[model samples]
Target: MSYKDGYKWRQKSKQGFKTKREAKEYGHVIVKELDKTALLTKDTELKDLTFKEFADMFLEIKKGHVTHNTLTMYRHAVDAYSSINNIKLSNIKPLHIQNVVNKMVSSPTTINSYYKVVSRIFYIAINPYKIISDNPCTGVRLPRVERKNMIHTISDEDLNKFAKYMREKYPQAYYFLQIARYTGMRLSEVYGLTWNDIDLKNRKISVNKQLQYVKGVITFEKTKTANSVRILPIPPILEKILIEYQTHELEFEYDLVLNPYKKNGVKCQINTYLKQFGENLSAHNLRHTYATKLLANGLDVKTVSALLGDTPAMVMKTYLHYSDEMKAAASNAVANIFS
Candidate 1:
């Protein structure tokens, strides 16, 4: 049986009664009892766990599951949450969480990230751990900031100029940029690419893994998600560029495509070159350009999502600027059919 406590719908009991009247009476009793007593009773042993202790346990549980970068972020959040160090898990309230968040001088995005880590810790404590009855992080209001699309894709004319300049001046940067622009692969995925993963004859580039920083050392790791491990088509222009690049670069370390450059500080090097073209572009902007071009040219969302190694929902959410235009075009096409 379930009951409504003003706006909140709460489950009263899982047991079934023989009659509707009995169920109604049982639910009423439960609601009255709930109003008189606490909604959730905490265990004596677990209720006394300090916020810092629970956070440490949470980090320990997350060690192997998350990437090195993600773990570092978690640690940073843990450090920021030291103000509530001695407070018991069940004793903490929304005001406590909100106070900690209000004290942070970071940007909205950074604060949000930290809040997420804290929120996850509280959530786990409520569920499987059962250390806390309620999540204190739930009702805390975050700073509101205007969301803007950060992708600064190159124009067709500018792309041509950028490509020519990179090819002539920085062959290595050109190779990296070409792979990223054509394939819509992430920077880490590109860093993980080797000669063996490239099927040049079949015109397909396999994305099996990515380069990740683990304990200050760069190493090969599984893709970000299961969908990330996919094969992308190599366009004719990209194929030509890769072929030339492969011929010139032989006997490299790990038989990798970009042996000398590595993963660290490569973005800075590319972005420095990007500034010369008079566009505020990063390595990821190339990927955005590729996906946007595909959607603008009339590719379906599912196909584009598959090609980009992301879910259709994520593709729609991220590329809504182009997707919205596509939606408008689709509406016109439907109207034209009736006409």
Candidate 2:
């Protein structure tokens, strides 16, 4: 045995530690000395934890604060990491995160969400658990997301044709599509609607809850924020449709106007029905069409924003694609002033 720098070391014979027990003892002593040195160097911090283990601990701590939807997204990100199969926690670098993000470029929103989850996990591991001295994701770069145009406008002629097609093919879903195109409500918001949420006397509907399908479970959750809880006035034509739909519901013994058969059915079923109508439009596209129509009709950005339950900046940034006639009308209005 020999001693150097407060650490004890031993030299074995030509066989180099004859028994497995001797090698195990040597390893234990070396680990103990390293722990002592680490303590003396700084605070006593936990060491040698794998990334997967630390991520689990971080998510456990985060579970109570976030919504179920958010937790599911985080779990998906962790699951994706596990599927990579070749990642080593100790050797993980920023490049690994970038590589994963690059592979998910087709889904920009999902990729960004995963990056946020990874960032949060590393943050908790570094500050709370002291699992690693530094976060490997610190300098990682996220993919650039190009925001797509959300405004989808149908001409009056096209809309009339669509309405006619709906009446012929999908009589049940026709009023639902009309309501969405007029009200600008999200698919979840529409699915969560009940008789109590509507005020026929005032020609308005109140947004209180949102329906979400997480892992195939249809759950009704609160709106994202108090600001998201809004009351939108129904158009006169839409009010008439609502009255008709209510009458139809009573006649058919259905609860919901759109889906009279099921109390709380999934909104994706509506999308399926729309496809059958030859419309090929999602519920969200109805909302987009609503906003575009409002913009084309000379409504100010703020009013359209409030009606769509979005900020003015979001409305202008996302849904300001105007038609040629609308653009020409604006030009003519200015030209008339000069004339």
Candidate 3:
């Protein structure tokens, strides 16, 4: 069991106790040990810290462990819970925390995200300081939410219409869209593409890194996952397009294929251009559409998983759920085998 504000700690016995009574007795012994060791008792042995004070210290400690983006998000989450920030660290009850959570005007997911930061702050207050015991976020009820993907599958008719419209009205965005549709690359992965990574001879791209634009600085960061660092085989149509696009003479930043415009600049431009073809169309939507079509056409989930730099479970849950053909196939497979 984890102690409140105590490093989110877990204490478990390796071997199973022979009887329920034995287990209960052992647990009682551990509870006594925790009472002596843990700083959660109402006793005034140490100074009571404010939630805000402990949160600041925890965030500073977390800087080296998480990405700058993640750290920034956590900071924002903490700021969102400012109503209870001044509460005594040990005095925070579940009801007090729940009331603060209920006050958030954001979605349930966003509220939960903020609550995690608050919960962690409480956790750290228990350890090294012994200020509190038991997390206040436990048993908090969150509203049900349907997840909306930034990436949406475009209908085949819309896809064709967009292709024609983009080519005629926005050639630069069209090329970017084509590359994304053909490769199923994430926005950052597409931006990070270079001539060196594009193997024309092998017809595969070495997706080892991605473009990270942080604080006006451009850097090559590791791929989102180890699976994201695999080779992406280029189709003949895409290879032809890339060959022609490479010939465009433009000053390169970090040898990026889409030159002149940097990652953020190009991303904004591309999204702006997509508005004419489809309302709220994004570069990410093209990738989702690509994965949807692949799953619809009988492509195995495992193969699709690797192609999209996602796990099989994720591929099935996110992309395959949209494919009626896949669902039909699953039904037919069970019927045919059993009957």
- Candidate 1: how large is its RMSD? 7.0
Q: What is the C-alpha lDDT profile of model 2 across 89-121, one tens digit per residue?
A: 445777777777767634777777787888777
Clash total of candidate 1: 0
Question: How large is the C-alpha RMSD of every model relative to the true structure?
Answer: 7.0, 10.3, 7.5
Off by over 4 Å in 3: 1-49, 61-68, 120-133, 147-151, 164-171, 260-262, 272-280, 323-325, 333-339
lDDT of 1 by residue, 90-206 (tens): 789999999999999899998999999999999998777766657899989999766666446777787777778877876667778889989999988998899999999999999
| TM-scores, each model vs. reference | 0.83, 0.66, 0.74
What's the lDDT for candidate 2?
Answer: 0.67
**Would you list the rank order by lDDT, best first?**
1, 3, 2
* lDDT (Cα atoms) of all candidates against the true structure: 0.82, 0.67, 0.76
Report the error of model 3 at residue 228, Å: 3.2
Residue 6 error, candidate 1, Å: 32
Candidate 3: tens digits of C-alpha lDDT, residues 274-296? 67667878767788888987877
Which window of ten consecutive residues has the lowest lDDT sum in model 3? Answer: 38-47
Clashing residue pairs in candidate 2 (N, C-alpha, C atoms within 3 angstroms): none
Better of 1 and 2 by TM-score: 1
Ranking by TM-score: 1, 3, 2
